[model samples]
Target: MTTKVRETQICLVVFIGLPGSGKTTLCRLLLEFLRTSCKSLSDILHHTISICYDELIPADKFRYQDESSQWKQARRGIVNYVKSLVFTLKDIEVLNMVNSLEVAVREELLKVVQNEKKTRVYIIVDDNMYYRSMRYEYYQLAKLYSFSFCQIFVQCSVSDALNRNSSREQSTAVPEEIITRMAERLEPPDRQNNPWEIFSLTVPSEKWTVAEIKKISLFLNNAAEHPVVMPERNNEMCQESRRICSTNVIHRVDIMLRKLVGDRMRERSQTSVQRDDLQELSKAFTDLRHHILEGIRTGTIIIPEDTYEAINLDQSNCGHRLQDFLNGLLTIS
Candidate 1:
């Protein structure tokens, strides 16, 4: 007798955006809308993980304050808000992500492709996914997993983000320098390079109406069924995945930085300079490196292990030491 097969579908949606840009809020709104109209989305909407009690300040737009009391209140708000979230990738996915980003992103994604039996693994990524390097890593993961990818670009004015942050009493937020850099790196999503569609939502004077929320919910329902397949690129030389073992976010970030500010940064050391002067050059590159990384997802540098060793840039030990050396460089020129 012939045996029948059992196939189950899994829908995954990765919501990426700059910090404090309203990704979580939109996700919440989307969930609220979905629960009422689309059963599929409603089912998943119950699993949101609040990052903070008040709100998540976009990394690119975060600010700092000196008042201790005010800062504590904002922190409390974020914690409370986080408590309200229904689902969090924390225990299952995020922990794995922190432990071994390379394995979590690359290996897990590859497993999905290699699996001959599993039907569908739909994942929805909900975070401030503004970095190109980070997004590229996920894109590479999708390619490895053979899973389709799409994008939902929520267009919000700076005023809106600032206003929302103010209401939350958040005295700290992603820096303006980072936000400026992101704008420089920002590339509008479309059907070409990523074939991932995008939607720009303009908040009505204040709150989103129930009907509008419902519309977003319906959209997610339809999107889950059919994901966008990335388009193939020609003259593809930069195809090898980044080698860093950190989370896709950090790894891709480092890769982008290295590419942007390669070794011999001061190759033309002005009027006169000795090889020993490379330290100054390295310092310059590091500062430029961080600022550049903040703007673009992927940068132009590509330093291998050999180069890291030669320049004494140890990935394992280059934590605070490296930051201290390059702190001044991260600033925008």
Candidate 2:
């Protein structure tokens, strides 16, 4: 009897930080550390590629809302290029797809692909992924491909980042304002909140030590060994879950509105309000509640489902809106 061996899986390491946070430098040090220090990892690792957004996106396209679509396309293209490289281990098709990339980037990619053997690979994506949504995109990609995903948050203060930016080459350096803005918006991995980001590490850019490198290598090794398992998809179950959630939200809102309407009716009754007017007010309130509930069910009204606090805040706002409607009805009566 022959023993069957499991093949090594690909790992995608996403770097999240602000500009001048030393993500690119860290990438270099990590690759070198893995290649030299971790002999076991180096043996199975066919190639380690670093994909820097600075090389892929133009300077003018940075930190601008207007260029978001372009940024998205570029990021998607990079992922596609990586997928092509992994599946085909060839750069010809990848190059044709990303011909807009810098010639130097193209050459480097070609060089790496040419040297790659049939073995496991690690891809480090270097970017100032300041938003959780930005990192989630890569996470989704990893989940789709059943690949191991990990995030490295390069921690650096705004002042330190700005200082580092000042010392860089004029052409390569980012503006101080962009770095500051990105730092303000940076959402570091919260493993507790996001289960997908459980395999995450945070490293101080100013304190790079052998111990830190070892820790990073260990983290990567663990992540690579345990690739993300794709969840079983059940459309019927998903639809049922959504229906139940929607029903619950509508029920809560209806109860709140009924209480508000009852209170308003009692207040009007104490003031000798007309019976017809009271009935009309009740009907109006019922209609408005129905409209609001419908909007929630259809997602026409935005409700934050991620946290109870957000839902409470939204409910408070809804209560205020309903109160205003009651006030308007009273004035009309």
Candidate 3:
């Protein structure tokens, strides 16, 4: 008799640190570490992990409202939220990252959680732990969801982090005031809640070093298949991501098809009313097509527009006709 193994519940990991604090670096490392660990322990060869960044959420729409338990996902209309998912959500109009803290957490984080049920996924939250000292909120989340998580803080001297960010070909992202604010409120993790074993050089029991920086870079490369944003480039990345899968990008060449054929067909018909009769219109069109086909087939050219205008269209539509339509729909893609 063969025993079937049940699927393991997914683990959610959230990293908190200020800008340049190395949350993004740790996230990359964790992805590789998680993949290796899953394979070794479960003997699952093709294990999958999905990492979602908090700032990448379309925050403008899901504005962070005042603190209230009612700010749960159900606060919005069902049909409206679904419509947002198809376009308005992904192709966000506004690009601001500020939101009501609690509400932002609920709506955006929940969206990530719900969308990640496709496989044995690892949900990584890449936010600096600038707010709450203990990750009790995360722990409560884990308890509610029947899975656990680890908090990794990439500890560094604020000046050192700030300096490292400055020297990179890239740039550091946080405003000076926010960095100062985070530092003032920063709390080093203690023993009882030693839940998150931090890593710097090797989980940072002290401060960061040149060797730690190298290790973190190596780790992030293994974590993700895509170049997800690291906060500073969040705006640029979000727009590019939206464009890559945009319907507008894919359909631009056919734009005139809508205008010339069906779009302006009504206007085109008025001009064609003087063709005397359907037979006359059809005969003129036949000759035009014949001429156009000869140009394409024989390469003599110069006759396509003569054919097009003979069909009662104009120079504006030199190549876009029935033939062009066929080439678009069937041949050239």
RMSD to the native, candidate 2? 13.5
Cα misplacement distance, residue 211 of candidate 1 (Å): 2.2
Clash number for each model? 41, 0, 10
Local error of candidate 2 at residue 132 (angstroms): 0.6
Question: Which parts of model 1 have CA positions greater than 4 angstroms off?
Answer: 1-6, 35-37, 40-122, 192-206, 227-259, 262-333
lDDT of each residue in 13-97, candidate 3, tens digit only: 4465656666676566555655554443333222333333333333332222211213223222221232232121223222232
Q: Between the candidate structures 1 and 2, which one is better when assessed by TM-score? A: 2
Clashing pairs in 3: 16-128, 16-129, 17-128, 17-129, 28-220, 64-100, 198-203, 199-203, 200-203, 200-204
lDDT of 2 by residue, 28-54 (tens): 899888766654444564446677777
- Report the error of model 3 at residue 306, Å: 86
Give every collision pair in model 2. none
**Model 3 deviation from the true structure expressed as Cα RMSD, one decimal place:** 25.6
Best by lDDT: 2
Candidate topping TM-score: 2
Please tell me which model should have the higher TM-score, number 2 or number 3.
2
lDDT of each: 0.42, 0.65, 0.40
